[model samples]
Target: MNFKHMTAAAVFAGLIAGCNVMGTPLPDPRLSGRDAEFMALAPQARVNSQFERYLVDYKTNEPVGSIIVDNNAKFLYYVMPGGKAVRYGVATGQDAMAFTGRAYVGGMQEWPRWIPPKDMLERWPHLQPTADAGGLPGGPDNPLGSRALYLYQDGKDTLYRIHGTNEPDKIGQAVSSGCIRMRDIDAIDLYNRVKVGTKVVVL
Candidate 1:
């Protein structure tokens, strides 16, 4: 109410307005217009765990048919010809008792509509019977992200997916309930290279 108090309040407000507070910086504004980076399949050029790195099969490994999931490392290796493999960051099951064993890529979908499973509804009472309540449209927010590869075994849905996530930061971690997650761009790239009936081995 006093002049001194008002002045202090104004300073504080200006500080916030000028990004003085310590917090996560917003995603790059320049990157916002680059929707293709968030939506389209692009080449993985970097190496190691860096954001730009995408492991590809080389030498003896080259998506030779066998796929191995190093869940511990949060990396999926598609064994390629020679001695090379395509390593990809992935978001795996949150629980230690998550998906294991073998499966195949039964089908693929783009910007697939997500339908919450019955169990998900049971666990979250607020969840609706259909995806409309929480399901995000096929775009930036969809949990399934830009692309999805349906995992199946013995001609049955494993209730698991090897898909893309909007939260690329969560990649290379154990976070999802029961899905193999990757960055949206990386997933799109992998989707194009893989096909139906590709055997996947998750360890």
Candidate 2:
């Protein structure tokens, strides 16, 4: 090709190389154990590349260490000490059940059990048997994948959670019962950064 054409193509490639492109499902050495679990789970689906975790510049009036869920954007930001945040892709609640406004992380659990709430059982009656059986035990098969941070307001359970998901591909979508779903490793990472009573704002 002509020299001018080659120069233009090189510029375009440089632009792409300079952009922030995150990879999905993480390749952290620590997650090697979970790789086996993932393989055993349902067939994996492709997550939108943009949904991957990122450290970005964020301007917010909220204080440091706060958790903010921008439901419209399908992103949950853990505000850092400065004007920065660690953002993670999330699957939010459907329109009829989405939780908005503010709440606190009232409780946290690792590898939490899956209890089909009464309302959920009402919608999915087949879950009644599981509910009657007193919920599914925590493990690889549980829907609350690796951890859970229970949201609460006014000292009452909001029946919503920010938890790990077995379906990472659902990130950047609206399909959950009401909880915020993150990739398993993302949940674990966020769990470590958060403590009970951390403020959570859903917008």
Candidate 3:
């Protein structure tokens, strides 16, 4: 190639490189390391595309800050402004075990303790310690994975929760006792986005 042609080609390549560098900044190495460490605690399973979080076209008259749980679809949507929402896969209660209707997030806990209810203890006698000892201490192995959002109606506890689960593979299924279950990482993300008084609609 001629010298002038070579120079022009080099300039074009340089411009393209510059644009790419400016457009896509590299992720912070420190943040990447932290993410790696966090994900190591709860490994995510390979999930289907439908179970992935996405910004979807959601039209709802309910105010922004409202959480909608589509039990049949096994999906949870945190409504946002401008007819959009952040959707996440969730595990709801099985057949007759599900709770329906509206409730508000009365409280939340990070790495909350797990106490087996009377019936649960009766069904699984091995879990008697969890009841007799008050509750199981929160940790990586805790059933409440990373966070728990307690549901309430008219200031009264509803005995239900939207919580993280130790079994990430069950995210898109209906298997919980009566509460909504999310993956550990997704739970943490939702916990950070929502407040104590956020409205929840379980359908």
For each candidate, the alpha-carbon lDDT, in order, equals 0.69, 0.83, 0.81
- Better candidate by lDDT, 1 or 3: 3
Cα lDDT for residue 157, candidate 2: 92
Per-residue C-alpha lDDT of model 1 across residues 1-203, encoded as one tens digit per residue:
24465677797787676663332222311223434654544322332343333444344332586667778778776665666566666878877546899899998987676777777777786657355565655666767887888889999988888887767777767888788888776676677668899988888
Root-mean-square deviation of each candidate, in angstroms? 13.4, 3.4, 8.1
What C-alpha lDDT, on a 0 to 100 scale, does residue 203 get in candidate 3? 88
Residues 1-203 of candidate 3 have per-residue lDDT tens digits of 24465677797887778554222221212223434554567656866667766777789889998999999999999998988787888999988889899999999998789998776777789998678888977666778877899999999998899998888888889898888998777787788789989999998
Model 2 segments beyond 4 Å from truth? 1-6, 17-43
- Looking at model 2, report the run of 10 residues with the lowest lDDT sum: 20-29
Per residue, candidate 2 scores C-alpha lDDT tens digits across 1-203 of: 24465677787777666664542233322544654465356335667766777777789999898999999999999998768888888999998889999999999998889989988888899999898888998776689988899999999999999998877778999999889998877887898889998999999
Model 1 TM-score?
Answer: 0.70
Q: Give the TM-score (vs. native) of candidate 2.
A: 0.86
Model 1 clash tally, residue pairs: 22
Model 2, position 133, has a per-residue lDDT of: 88
lDDT of 2: 0.83
**Could you give the candidate ranking by TM-score, starting with the highest?**
2, 3, 1
